[model samples]
Target: AVNLAIAFAMQGHENKVGLLDADLHGPCVPTMLGMQDQKLKVGPIGAFPALGPLGVKVVSMAFVLAGKEVPVVWRGPLKMRAIEQFLSEIAWGELDFLLIDLPPGTGDEPLSVLKLLPEMDGVIIVTIPSEVSQNVVGKAITFAKQLNVPVIGIVENMSGFVCPDCGKETHIFMKGGGKKIAQEYSVPFLGSIPLDPRVCEASDMGHPFIMEYSDSPASKAFMIIVKKIKAFISERQS
Candidate 1:
């Protein structure tokens, strides 16, 4: 999701993007973006998101936590309130796209965000190429449909692993599950991102992999997915 946000921001022309880390239990977006220690600036109006790479505005609970080791152990109601504040209290300013990264599941965090943003463009479900992961995609699609939220599509991450030396692709988690499920549910298959070691390194260093390794297969896949997402949104608007 962080990579996708970066992809949209790095699209050359002036495109304003804001990423809300709605995954309350594990707000790793800040850490992955290399701003875990950064805090949101508050003024009389509201709080301002931290400026991330490629000028993407980012908001996450990790910024307000006492430390990296701190955990958000709150009930559902508390979490719902926090999300409400995140949406209403943050001065997101004007944005071309505001991507909310929800935790995996049809749980409270996603439910709250969906209810709050009834006019949301859509929800993009990310999954790995495994039966276990694909099974959850069905539930997610149903969840969005039940709530009257559009399912933008499905993104298959860690689809396959390419050996650095041999350049051979290995189906570590079994391939084509994403497209299969997308076909099963009649949703668009945005693209598949192959597993790359550099992605992990970039994440740890808080770098946007799509920018740093734009030529890599995974990065290329991200670009394709971003284009599809943009087209989807454009079509809906038209």
Candidate 2:
């Protein structure tokens, strides 16, 4: 989701974007952006975010860890503090959009980010087209509403898989769960992303799938979602 947002923002040269990997327990932005070995540099004021493809500024715990194998065994308070610092201390300069990739579920990290960035534009909830995911995502929506944080939309990821050999589409996790949730919750249904092997392969190779596989169905779906997000933002601003 973060990568897709960055790629969409990078489509035009006018927008300045940044991604904050607030999922400290399993920070993957650095790895996904191919900066696993890199470290965040401390400037005079605060730590500097690493530059990524299309000039997207990125900050993640993966950059701070000595290695990928090193585990983040911090407690709740510690995790909250780290999240606070990531928001307050990172040198995120003049960003038009800053996408915070919160850890899954309504957990400590998500709460900390909401508390810290109270004026967040909104959240884009990502879920699979499954009943279990639908139930859990409902809790997320309630949590956001309780905090008075708007939900921009919901994205149903891995909605289906298309066979490369025969070009047949399979509803791997079952379909319409995302839109059903959106309708029940009264939030906008952004779009559904079909499962594509290239998405996984791109992540493994430290590349943005939207950029590398622009012609794929998954990428096309992602772009449609991005357009909806932009429209939401514009509507809010207007």
Candidate 3:
């Protein structure tokens, strides 16, 4: 959800936007956002102060835990409370969006996020091209609908492989599962992102592709996706 948050922020929404990484088991947003070093100071009333009122804010169970590398061994309620701390405790003044990135499945993390924010504006489902991913997301959509949350759109990440020298492309992750799913559910197909080597490089160097290489094709596509999100938000908010 860091991508979504940063993208929204880049689209000129200067207001505060918080990202809660409910994936306690696999928290990557902290490292991805280059906010790994700061100690997550959770207040007695659950207020985390570093994330300012109008800047981009992020919180995760991994950040709040003893150590990011240490295992978060806990049951359902325990996990739920941690999610609560990340949500209720954070001092997100006002937000254009609170992009909560749940782990890529219908597990405790996602369950906790849904239960925590039942009135979420919308969920932008991210997935690669595969039956496994699509099948699981069908369940996710059904569950989201069950909780009365809308499926805003589907983002097909790593949808194609970009050639290094010639600029050719290949749908290495199976096929157009995103389009099929979008068609099936009557949701918008936001955009497709080709797998670029630079994206991995940026991740390794601790920056997201959009910020690192804003002019790359993948970055441009990311910007377009952000535009789509902004349009969606504008239309919905109005």
Candidate 4:
């Protein structure tokens, strides 16, 4: 989600973007974007999100927590209220796109987001090239459809691994699961992101892989996925 947000933000300044880290249980967006020490600036009107790379406004529970070690152990009502405040109270300010990073499940947080923001454009379900992960894709699509929300597409992450020395790509997790699942469920397969060690390293160091390693195979795949998403939105609008 952080990579996609930064990628879209990289499309020059005209397209403004905001990232809402709605994964209440695990708010990693701030840590991934190197905003661990930042906090939301609350004024009389509302709270202002922290400015991330390429001018992407960001809001996460990580920003309000006492520390990274602190846990958010709240009930459903509390969580719903917090998410509601995050949506309506934050001063996002003229966003061309607001991407909500949801937890991997059809749970309270995801349900709350969909229920609150009925106008959400769609959801891009990300899955790894594994049967277990692919199983979740169907559930996610059904969840969205049941809520009358559109399933934008599916993105396959860590699809392959390329040996740096030999330059040969290996399907470490098994090949073509993403495309196969997309076909099975009749949804668009955006692209496959090769497993790059640098992607993990960059994330740990609060850097977006696309910006840090644009020439890498994984980064190139991300660019392609972003373009496909824009195309999907364009087609819908037209």
Model number with the top TM-score: 1
TM of each candidate vs. truth: 0.97, 0.96, 0.91, 0.96
Task: For candidate 4, write residues 1-238 as lDDT tens digits.
Answer: 9999988887653338999999998998988888899999999999999998888899999988888899999988999999999999999899878999999988999999999988888999998898877778889999998999888899999898889899898888888888999999899999998899998899899998889999888888888888888888889889
User: What ordering of candidates by TM-score runs from best to worst?
Assistant: 1, 4, 2, 3
RMSD of each candidate? 1.1, 1.3, 2.2, 1.2
Q: Which window of ten consecutive residues has the lowest lDDT sum in model 2?
A: 6-15
* Candidate 4: RMSD to truth: 1.2
Q: Residues 42-129, candidate 2, lDDT per residue (tens digit)? A: 9999998888878888888988888889999998899999988888898888787788898889999999888878888899999999
What lDDT score belongs to each candidate, Candidate 1 first?
0.91, 0.85, 0.76, 0.89
Which wins on lDDT, candidate 1 or candidate 4? 1
Q: How many backbone clashes does candidate 4 have?
A: 0
The per-residue C-alpha lDDT of model 3 at residue 64 equals 63
Model 4: pairs clashing at backbone N, Cα or C within 3 Å: none
Residue 150 shift from truth in candidate 4, angstroms = 0.5
Off by over 4 Å in 1: 12-15
Write down the RMSD of candidate 2 (Cα, Å): 1.3
lDDT tens string, model 3, 88-153? 767776777788888887888788888778877778888888887888878878878888877888
